[model samples]
Target: MTDAPLGRSAAFKVLTTGYVGSTGPGVAATVSYLTDAGRHLIFDPGMVASPEAILAPLAALGLGPEDVTDVVLSHHHPDNTMNVGLFPRALVHDHKVEYRGDQWKNRDAEGYELTPSLRLIRTPGHSPEDITLLAGTPTGVVAFAGDLWWHSAGPADDPVAPDRDQLRASRERVLAAATLIVPGHGAPFTPDATTPR
Candidate 1:
């Protein structure tokens, strides 16, 4: 993979696309953006796509991987981090705790600044290495909350629920910091987004 410069200011755009899966119509992947000193930085690149899958949408935006300076993964799950190698020149970011031995030598989680407008928070629970990207965008402080809390399930279903105290703390952190939330596998939620029934 090649490393690119992270944008100094942050900006974001969402790309909604289909992912073939068993969960009925699968959820859309939320791709966040940051303007690194005028360049573009993409948060997570979902499952690998064929050349055709990448062309149309990207062309619509007039962007290609070369235009993407970095990719910050929220965790190591294949669904979230599978396309890390595709951007042959973009640097990959993730949390240190999520490193699975040597499988990810090029990934970094030490928390690099994506842009003056963005910050990365390590919010482990659903997975020990899960991290959320926090940014102050024009809308509000938006949290790219990767699987830390899923809109589809209540906190009770979180894999870390057995540790109620930790889960509660994690939830509180998200609620307190997020005025807007972008969850890993569901619709974007307003400040009132909460665990569903």
Candidate 2:
């Protein structure tokens, strides 16, 4: 299938795609929809290498760029935030300490509250200011772990982690808080279940 299955629950909903082989360096757009109090919000707009590739899949699902009220980035890497500039009208949110190389765009460092049920958590370690979207989903609270662990890259790669200690600590924190995880490059999984060690 060109797109991954999108699901919803009482608290929030998500169309998790882009964790495919065709998108940006093997990354694609993963869009989360949080509906509360008559308001709609978006989380982790997806990795942006081929701009149209990212937007096309999301658009086919009836979620357009103009509909985005806020773009919550899991991290500052190009794969995650490259096409962020596409949303001209939305407020962009990121961790205060994020390291942006050459790509530039409008963003906020302070943690944001799109609504009480949805927010950004500073789950750094993968990057200086990497953040994960902590929101209520079908299975449970899901953390969109960005590069915290590379599921397919194998144990020897350690998923290209720069800091071993921080990675472990980040994993633990995410594990403690989120029952479901939408990892950066894999299908959503349960952390409590046995994961690749």
Candidate 3:
């Protein structure tokens, strides 16, 4: 994927890089820009996109791998987690249910959060451990929907979800919580963009 914009949140401008065929599927990746004055967060660095393809966007924003302070994966899928090693110095956040060791679950007892600005919505549909990242942007809330729903799917479905009910609830919550979403497999789009008029 190319470096598409995902709007800005506070001192950072978020961007994305499309799948580069580094793996079987081309899952879109997310990158963020932040100086020491801002929190540098990278969500879903992508699986198939080449290292250069993924990092170049950040480079364009004057951010190096080490500059990233946080790496949050929506799930354990290689598409979202494989490239994490690229940011060795970053603190990784994820639902522990998806990994074996040294992982973290919902920051709260309810498996979700809406504190301050960054909200981690525990959306267990595509995977039981998936969590969507919602950041308060200047435009509005931007959701980093990691496999919450494939971009190709219509408003009514998330075909890969193991639990249909959970996926439905998750979608509803995301639709309500975010104005824009950077999906795991497709381009960034607005919830209203996919809604039926």
Candidate 4:
């Protein structure tokens, strides 16, 4: 899982930064855009105020839904997969399957490489089906970790996690593997001493 920084390689952009209100009002999933090996990918096209919140940014990047070759769901949670159908032409990926045009293909997500620079790995914690998308970009390894971390400010532990121990271990693996992490509901962050394990 080590990669030297390349002069030109995969790249990623935050399409919409999400938020979790302290009082349970404001919320959305952080949608992301990634480009690797001529593939346009969307990560977690989930709950948002509107589809435009996600689409406008992609449009700004000169991409339409049809241009999205793939969409990766970090988990089956509504917040992480609600708007998956927006990308009509994309092959949707879950932890254990790939869906496209009414056909479901079974596959293992653990270490599944979508491209030389984009890979998927199971990191169940926030949910048993949770997975993470790791992108080897020119900058460094960027992990689109779902609620394995809700945000940079670790709740220390996920309050709703079925198994806190598994959550902790998953966090450790993500921390060890990614130099930058795009959490489920926050801006991208560089893990530091303050980051929870």
Candidate 5:
């Protein structure tokens, strides 16, 4: 519910508490920057609520789907990429080799730039399409680790199995570079907070 600027990025955290008449569940979306070029980047459009419900808050941040120049999807899951259609003009970015049979036609995951302050990391964990975002902040390099690492009660309980060993490797890849970790559904913390050092 707090719309505050984190560093040079216009970041907003919209908390949707679960209850009757509520907006599903808690979630947060980060808008990477307010550019002089009239462009902005959004990361992970979650499923905590319908895109319509968050329109007002998004507008308050001087953003609407039309104004968004790029959308970085951490994965193909509904919670992350479902609202993609809302941003018809914005280029969608993801690591999914093939996302939902052409829903990702114009999707570009080949190192698309997300503001001058951030870059995308292809991290396939929770799913083959999963990826983590790396951004430079005042604190340091913070990785928006979609479902790669949960920050709640414990580490990711359901890590991708050996069949998807690539995912586990991907986690290692990000952890190696990640200084701070911002998960998809929990509080943000340092990578060491979850890694056994």
Candidate 6:
């Protein structure tokens, strides 16, 4: 298979950077936007300081919530799914189904392609249902991996991961394929030797 799978590359940008503190209540979810094959997508549009944390950046790019075509949740955690209602017109995708309006279509996310440049792969670890969105941009492949690394530094060990072995395997899969990673919380960064395994 090709690196991008089958179509023109998409463009992506981070809307907001997320944070998780080791010893306080401070936390938020990173959000991102992507446009590809005529589709406007938002990944992990989760908890933020406010809705504007996501909306304002999207608005700056000339889009409103209604303009979003899809929203992909990496898992079921509220911190990674709370703002889904903001995009009323967008289809919502999770590991096992796609939902829009009241219609729910069952489909396995593994190898599923929403666009030539965008596809989904099952990467359960952080959560049993976690999946990753791999977007092929002009520069390289970018993986929107929720809670997998937590950030570039990685917690090294997820405090709540049910399957550490599975998590490690999933991380290997992503690291071998992606040039940059848009973690669940924090700015995107290129993977390197220092990246937690």
Q: How well is each residue in 25-110 modelled by candidate 4, as lDDT tens digits?
A: 76899999999889999999999999999999999999999999999999988988889989999999989999999899999999
Question: What is the C-alpha lDDT profile of model 6 across 19-124, one tens digit per residue?
Answer: 9998858889999998998899999988998999999999999999899999999999999999999998899999999999989999999999999889899998
lDDT of 3 at 165: 85
Ranking by TM-score: 6, 4, 3, 1, 2, 5
* lDDT tens digits, residue span 65-181, model 3: 888877778888776777878887776777643222366453531233323456566778888888887776667777777777555344356556778888877777777777777
Better of 2 and 4 by lDDT: 4
Error of 4 at 102 (Å): 0.8
1-197 per-residue lDDT for model 1 (tens digits): 11111322456665543233435445435555555356566666665345334434555788876776667788777666656565666756788532232545544443545565666766676777777777666656677777665553543466533455655666667677666677765556775544531
| CA deviation > 4 Å runs, candidate 3 | 1-14, 19-37, 97-115, 152-156, 193-197
Error of 4 at 124 (Å): 0.8
Clash count per candidate? 8, 1, 2, 0, 0, 0
Tell me the lDDT of model 4 at 93. 92
* RMSD over all Cα atoms, model 2: 7.2
lDDT of each: 0.59, 0.59, 0.63, 0.89, 0.56, 0.90
Whose lDDT is greatest here? 6
For model 5, residues 96-183, the per-residue Cα lDDT tens digits are 3423324545444545445555656666657766777676555566777776754433244444333346656776777676666666
Instruction: Please provide TM-scores, in order, for all candidate models, with all chains considered together.
Output: 0.73, 0.71, 0.76, 0.95, 0.67, 0.97
- Residue 151 of model 5, lDDT score: 47
Worst 10 residues of 1 by lDDT: 1-10
Q: After superposition, how far is residue 158 of candidate 3 from its true place, in Å?
A: 3.0
Candidate 6's clash total is 0
Clashes of 1: 8
- Candidate 2: global Cα-lDDT? 0.59
The positional error of residue 16 in candidate 5, measured at the CA in angstroms, is 6.6
TM-score of 3: 0.76
